[model samples]
Target chain A: MDLATAGLKTTDHDGIIRIDFIERNILDEANIQLIGEGLNHVVDAMDEPKLVICFENVEHLSSAALGVLITASNRVGSKGGQLRLSDINEQILEVFRITRLDQMFQIYDTSAEAMSAFS
Target chain B: MAESPGHHDERRDSDSSRSGVVVLHDVRTELDSLQRAVVDGIRHAGYDEASTFAVRLALEEAVANAFRHGNGEDPEKVVTVEFKISDEKVWIAVEDEGCGFDPDAVPDPTEEANLEIPSGRGIMLMRAYMTDVSIVAPGNRVEMVFRPAG
Candidate 1:
């Protein structure tokens, strides 16, 4: 699959940007760049009270990808927003489990569920 | 087989019964999903626990290194991974078609300045885990071997 076809989008609601990423295969700099760039766009606007990044369709995630997620989460958290994830598949979740990262990030089963929590 | 432990000898006999390699391509988007296929292909051939883990760790490190460093954000580079399992060990090779780097020149991560960094650990991890590790032909090839213990 092409890197960009991974599905990255964001929406602004009530001054909060909700970034969604759908990735497959090995997530590296190229794919994470999509997430980074999208988040940066929202961060630049600085109009959001909170931000959430929802990962969907991502099957396998590498440490490199995790690094990017952590970086994005830190950036959002520093700006008074939160970087959250939802719809994380089982295979991808195994990596998080192995690394004990499940406790480090807020995860949800659906984007609506995550957004509702923010609301 | 002649000098191995009782169960291990039998295991070796069983292992020799099936041995081969699996080739996969275009499944880059589903690496975890493909892992099962790759792992199963090796274990089914009768590699032991330690050997299997060694091969798996090496493959993970190499493929990841290729995806991040060699491919360099290009999905079209076509990272190819192949593995061969035997009674005594497993050999895994990951091939990437990108500009190469000098492996010998990499700064030791154990050094104080690089200890906290994430970028240079893959190769070190592979070397630490695999029984034999080598970079071939301008870094385009990585061959690792996991020898069975006793």
Candidate 2:
């Protein structure tokens, strides 16, 4: 996906799609909308898609960003696909833990770990 | 969960030497400058990364809540943002044009049943990040403060 259009770098490793955020801060309202749509497109493109959202480059994100992730996870799960999150920084991880999203999502430390976990 | 305990209604006498109040009709157009006004002041006051993250998240959520739920997504209605940044803490309050609701009536997003719901987590995150987060009643206005650990 185009970086500005999606704020993401999506690559296929075998059949698993690993998506990386190109923007350091994912807090803007307009950009977050683009990202939500882009992620939905990726999830809808494949049958039982296994996706990895790696936050290795993201420095900050607001609650709106988290909402998009939950939306993507729900959409993919309904289609029998799987989603994993990886490389989230401590600050962002705290946001997840506080909201108990850490319990709701499959979080891994690395992209490879997430891919492997996708059965 | 609800808010930081016990200190909800007590506003600080004076914690910071600098402050600003910004009123905007469309949050989409104003969020960047609004962010800079608050974040730059916090940085200038020498707060750490964690503090900055906490303040920024709370600020964004509060402003978005004012824009969306409070104003009902109407661009013509203004959102007023007031901020004070000091060496000890950053205090911000965002007020909307519409009538308010009870903050306590909002459901907890972290509960097992509500976990899958995407939208209700804004207030939860604000309460989590801010040292103190409270809604000034009639509920259209939220006041937040984040003090860096010593």
Candidate 3:
């Protein structure tokens, strides 16, 4: 089931799939839906079990967007697969800290580091 | 009987003394403008980047809760937002036209059993980012405050 997800950029690194998000800010319902649907596509298209979501440019992430991440994490976990994050801005990292999601998701300094985690 | 969208208004005091009120329909399209106005207002009030980010995050969460849970995404309903910036504090309030829930009853999202649950984290993030979070008007309205660093 291929869905239209213009908000995300996908790349294949070895066997790990890396999804770099282009949306710098995820605020309104439309953008939130974009992230949610984009992740759904990634999860569904996972011939490989490992995935890394990079927030290199996303400075503002609303709780709604966080909900999308949580849902994606759950979907990956259900398949005995892993989902991780990289390049999170410091300000946005505070949000993850406040919610303690930093503990739930493995976070790294770069996409390379996150990709290496799959090994 | 649905009221048309774009029927809302925004009012800023003539003095422009770092305070204003924005009344909006439950329309989702209006949120982007509201958030931009609030962010610009807070920045103009001399909040640093970190403080501004925290306040903005909390404000977005509160407003999203009103639109999503409070009004059940009913465009006919209304969501009223009020914000004030003082010398040392920034305050925001969001009220929805739906029957409110008990904030106390929301379980902690950080709990191991609840980590994967996505619904309850909005309230938790609001409380975490804001200096104070209070539910008023029978839980229909949420008020949050942020105290800036010196």
Best by TM-score: 2
Q: Pick the candidate with the highest DockQ.
A: 3
Q: Which model, 1 or 2, shows the larger TM-score?
A: 2
lDDT by residue (B60-127, candidate 2, tens digit) is 88888898899999966778788888887788989988899888889998889999988888888888
Docking class of 1: incorrect
Residue-wise C-alpha lDDT for candidate 1, range A9-93, written one tens digit per residue: 5677665566655545436433555655555656656743476666675544555666566666666667776767788876567
RMSD of each: 9.6, 6.3, 2.6
Query: Candidate 3 on B32-148: residue-level lDDT in tens?
Result: 777787777777666788887788778878888898889998977788888887657888988898999888788888888987787788888888888999999589999888997
lDDT of 3 at A80: 80
Whole-model lDDT values for every prediction: 0.61, 0.83, 0.79
Clashing pairs in 2: none
**Tens digit per residue, CA lDDT, model 2, A10-110:** 99999999998887875466578889988998999989989999999887887788889999999999999999999998988988999999999999999
* Clash pairs, model 1 backbone: A15-A48, A25-B29
**Order of candidates by lDDT, top first?**
2, 3, 1
* lDDT, residue A75, model 3: 88
**What's model 1's lDDT at B147?**
76
Q: Comparing candidate 1 with candidate 3, which one achieves the higher TM-score? A: 3
